[model samples]
Target: MKARAGGPDHRPPLISEHDRDAAVHRLQEAYAEGRLSHEELDESLHQVLTAKTHSDLASFPEENESTIAAVSGRIRRRGVWRVPRILKVESALGRVHLDLSRAVIEHPVVDIEVHLGTGNARITVPRDAIVDVEDLRTGWKDPLYKTRRRSRPGGPMIRISGTMGLGRLKIRHARR
Candidate 1:
């Protein structure tokens, strides 16, 4: 096990119960959404159940081009990454961080779906963009994460929704 910086030697994250449940839950969600066939779900579920490391879920990102980060494991999308029209992010036992402060937004309205289990998600946006998370969580976790809309004419807008089981959703303003 590799040690975290200034932290104790870490056991493989795959051994965590949250990771195990997250993997299965993600596959079930995909199956329910008609994104996975019966055979695929069965195969994927078997793989996840028997996975030795978190890397075993690499096949998930290949499922779609609209995904900004890893589908099953820890996901972090930062810097100048491209922003798609609609983004779906899922993490079971890990964290999901999307830094859209410098991302290129080609759409006036962007939709983001978040599903997490015992894991947290954070989205950072620039001052110019509008954020609306009211349909999701209560806005007290982070000062920047408000449900109110703040748009400037044709400025971009992001709509975030979905579930966070035993986790939190936070939004922060990026440094200008």
Candidate 2:
């Protein structure tokens, strides 16, 4: 059955973190190309950040993301998977592991938003990547991360954020 525009299945497209980031990047590029003035770029950036649906992003570029979620058991993402600019992982009562050391990373900055209810999360980052967990919040324990070597000048910056209800988050740089 073909539904009307305002029908249940015709709901607007939901906005994701990657969408907003892509829009901001496009707006910046437009400003750099002299298509948008400074004030216009600022206004567009504000609008992009606050966008909630596809219509709100009408004037900007579009991009998608990936999500890994589970209710129980274990969740793992390793191997040579393609990494998106924004990746979200959620689990209710399971362990989560993400290995980005050998994954295909195409962006300069990667955002991993994890929302775990009751399990630990382990992330293996690239050898030359830089990590920042300053915005991560935890209800039980702090995240464990150690820098064994200095980050390269143009290496990827992995920014991990989100809330953990009751578990540890361990991060380690991959070996060469």
Each model's number of backbone clashes? 0, 0
Candidate 2 overall lDDT versus native:
0.85
Residue 104, model 2: lDDT of: 90
Question: Runs in model 1 with CA error above 4 Å?
Answer: 1-65, 68-72, 137-144, 147-153
lDDT of each: 0.70, 0.85
Candidate 2: pairs in clash: none
Over 1-176, each residue of candidate 2 has an lDDT whose tens digit, in order, gives 89999898788878988888888888988666434546767778888888899788748433436898899999998999998878999999999999999999876678899999999999999999999999899999999998766666867789999999999999999986
Best candidate per lDDT, number? 2
Model 2: C-alpha RMSD to truth? Answer: 10.8
Model 2 segments more than 4 A misplaced: 1-26, 29-61
